[model samples]
Target: MADVILYRWSTERDTWVSASEVEEARAYLARQGITTSALPDGRFALAGESARAFGAERLVFLGLQQLRGTRSA
Candidate 1:
């Protein structure tokens, strides 16, 4: 399993939209002039500007750290 980070963006009208994929999330952040950084723990961290723009109330991390281990089956 791959460790993927999820993100949700809020429009100016206050409507929220969830990213369907990692790339989508990245693109959205990029469009907002946000830069993402890879942390040593194998997680992505949003830049300060991005974080502020995303708003603590509007940003959500779904299933974060759920893919920390390999699946056996």
Candidate 2:
């Protein structure tokens, strides 16, 4: 299956954190010899055994962005 990259906009930091969870996952995968590539615009590409090992995954993808005075999740 094709790799899916999730995205989320951080209101606290006020920036796009692409594949945010992937980074954390990569750390563990790295120990097992997995390779990950961070793409432009906060995206990530994962390959090798790590991808297969950490294959089944779920992501928040993105939270709503609220205008000043507006609320979003």
Candidate 3:
């Protein structure tokens, strides 16, 4: 099974948003003027207080399945 990493955004009006891709999350961070540095471990390190102010966290989505064929009933 493969795992996917996603970003969870802060709640708003009892609702929340998540970024499904790295670029998507980076775009949002960039808009907030939050800089991210690449770590030697292939992970990102958020810069400054934006980390706390952003209120976003990394989440792991596991056991994702992509069905390739239609089911026969």
User: Which one wins on lDDT?
Assistant: 1
Clashing pairs in 3: none
* lDDT of every predicted structure (CA atoms): 0.40, 0.36, 0.37
lDDT of 3: 0.37
Cα-based TM-score, every candidate: 0.34, 0.33, 0.37
Off by over 4 Å in 3: 1-20, 49-73
Sort by TM-score, top down from the best: 3, 1, 2
Q: Could you tell me how far off, in angstroms, the CA of residue 46 lies in candidate 2 after the best superposition?
A: 2.1
When summed lDDT is taken over every stretch of 10 residues in candidate 1, the lowest stretch is: 1-10
User: 1-73, model 3: which lDDT tens digit per residue?
Assistant: 1112312222232223243444455554555565665555545666763343222234111011111111221
Task: lDDT for model 1, please.
Answer: 0.40
Q: What is the number of backbone collisions in each predicted candidate, taken in the order shown?
A: 0, 1, 0
Clashing pairs in 1: none
- Candidate 1, residue 5: the lDDT equals 28
